[model samples]
Target chain A: DQQVKQNSPSLSVQEGRISILNCDYTNSMFDYFLWYKKYPAEGPTFLISISSIKDKNEDGRFTVFLNKSAKHLSLHIVPSQPGDSAVYFCAASNRANAGKSTFGDGTTLTVKP
Target chain B: DVKVTQSSRYLVKRTGEKVFLECVQDMDHENMFWYRQDPGLGLRLIYFSYDVKMKEKGDIPEGYSVSREKKERFSLILESASTNQTSMYLCASSSLGRVWGETQYFGPGTRLLVL
Candidate 1:
């Protein structure tokens, strides 16, 4: 069973615009959510994360919003740039299970320059 | 900066062959993981080790085994390779001290092809 799911396989947005990537999860036990950005032929790098307590967390150009009621979270990039184009993966895990994470099928973001 | 290095970028092996994939980390992390990435299927964990001489099976550990004789190195062993095992393999390491669910750092993946 897929605990984490990303419905959209790909997304396209214009540069200097906002890019939103959505993800959903079936497991309510997951209290922490993280996003990773991956480039072609390269490993995924950590982007941003949010805890269940907070509804939103922001880091520079990236912002992540979490809704516990909906069991959904989204990663938003403001003024998206060409460098923002990459595959974004949403992962969920709880404190008890520290290193084991359930990752969603990544969403490929394309920022048109 | 933490660095995770895989043994190879690409490899081709014949069926029924024993395949070994090595991974090393320079950060002295206590947690190491091995995952396989297929097209459409995201990263699926095959095995993980929290410390030297300790290991745990992940979501998909069938037809595969792992070893961690040393803290800095982890190895994935395929007893008998099959065509279905052809995929991109990734290695990741994370520190136990982090707060947000152990932020994992990954290395460049190794693409293995079983013919």
Candidate 2:
């Protein structure tokens, strides 16, 4: 069973537009949610995260919103640049689980110039 | 910044050959993990260690074993490599006793192919 799911395998957006990637989770025990960005031939890097206590967290160009009732989370990048193109993964972990993260299938985002 | 390094960026091995993939982390992290990434399956954890000389099996650990003799190093061993094991292997480290959510730092990844 896939606890975390990224239904969309890929997404395309125009430069300077908003790019939104969605993710859903089936486990309600997950308390912490995170997003990681990965490029070709490279490892994934931490992008943004949101705790279950808060509904939203924003960092510069990246923002993550969490809806606990719906068990869904979304990552939004405003004014998307070509360099923002990469595979994005959504992961969740509960404090009781000792931070062992369960990651999604990942969504490949392409920002067109 | 946490830096995780893998021994090789690419490797090739034959079936039934023993393979070892080494990983080292600069940060004094207490937790280390090994994961395999496939084309459509995403990243699946093979094994993880919470402390030196201590380890646990992840979701998929059938063909893999792990060793952690030192705090900064973790190794994944394939007793007999097979063609189906060909994929990208990723190593990650995370410090324990942090906040509610701890972020893991990953290595560049080692692409392994078995003939």
Candidate 3:
């Protein structure tokens, strides 16, 4: 059973437009959510995170929003650049349990010029 | 900066052969993890170690074993390699945290192919 799911396998957006990636989770115990960006042949880099206590968290050009009632979260990147093209993964964790994190299947985002 | 290194970036092995994948971390972290990445499956945990000589199975641990003799190093062993085991392996290390969540630092990854 996949605890976390990214319904869309791929997403495409024009440069300078907003790119939105969505994720859902079935585990209610998860309290912390994070987003990671990965390039080809490179390790994933931490992007932004949101705690269950808050509905939203923002970093520079990236923003993450969480809806606990819906068991869903989304990552939004405004003014998307070509460099933003990569696979994005949504991860969730319940720190109380050994800090193990569950990750989604990842969404490949392509920012077109 | 935290650095996690894998023994090999790519490896090819024949089916039924024993394979060992080694990972080392320089950050003195207490938590270490092993994950396998597939094309559309994302990252799935195989094993994780909380301390020296301690380990716990993750989401997918079948046909895989792990050893953590030292706090800085973790090893994943495939007793008998199979074609289904071909995937990108990743190692990560992180420090335990109380409130401010722990951040996992990952290695580049090792691509393994079993023919």
Candidate 4:
């Protein structure tokens, strides 16, 4: 059973526009959510994260919104650039789990230049 | 910068052959993990070790085994390689900071193709 799920396999957006990637989870025990961006032939890097206590977290052009009631979270990149085109994976974990995160299938975002 | 290095970027093996994938981390991290990334299946944890001579099975640990004789190195071994085992393998490490849920730093990945 996949605890974390990304319904959309891919997304396309124009440069300078906003790119939104959505993710859902079935486990309510997860209190921490993180996003990772991966490029071809490279490893994934941390993007943004949000805690269950907060509804939103923002850093630069990246913003992550979490809704505990819905067990859903979304990553938003405003003014998306070509460099933002990559696979985004959503992961969830709880403090007691020793950082063993349950990752989603990942969404491939394409930013049109 | 933390650096996680895998033995090979790519490898090919035949059925029934034994395969070993090695990973080394420069940062003195206490936590090391082995994950497999398939097309539709994001990243699945195969094994993880929190310290030298310690190990734990992740979600999918079948058909594979791991060793961490040293704190800096972790190895994933396939006793009898199968075609179904062909996939991208990733290694990650994180320091058990003052907190336990530290972020993980990943390697470039090793793409293994089992024939």
Query: Can you give the TM-score per candidate against the true fold?
Result: 0.97, 0.99, 0.98, 0.97
Model 3 chain B: weakest 10-residue lDDT segment is B97-106
DockQ, model 1, C-alpha based: 0.77
- The per-prediction tally of clashing pairs is 0, 0, 0, 0
DockQ of 4: 0.63
Report iRMS (Å) of candidate 2: 0.8
TM-score winner: 2
Q: lDDT tens string, model 3, A56-82?
A: 999999999999999999999998999
lDDT of 3 by residue, B1-115 (tens): 9999999999999999999999999989999999999999999999999999999999899999999999999999999999999999999888896574667889999999999
Tens digits of per-residue lDDT, candidate 1, B7-111, equal 999999999999999999999999999999887898899999999999999999999999999999999999999999999999999988877687899999999
Candidate 3: stretches off by over 4 Å: B98-100
Lowest summed lDDT across 10 adjacent residues in model 4 chain B is found at: B94-103
What tens digits encode model 1's per-residue C-alpha lDDT throughout A6-103? 99999999999999999999999998899999998888888998988899999999999998999999999998999999999999988888578889
Candidate 4, residues A1-113, lDDT tens digits: the string is 88999999999999999999999999999988999999988888888888888999999999999999999999999989999999999999877776678889999999999
User: Candidate 1 chain B: minimum summed lDDT over ten consecutive residues — where?
Assistant: B95-104
Question: All candidates' lDDT scores?
Answer: 0.94, 0.95, 0.94, 0.92
- Winner on lDDT (2 vs 4): 2
Clashing pairs in 2: none
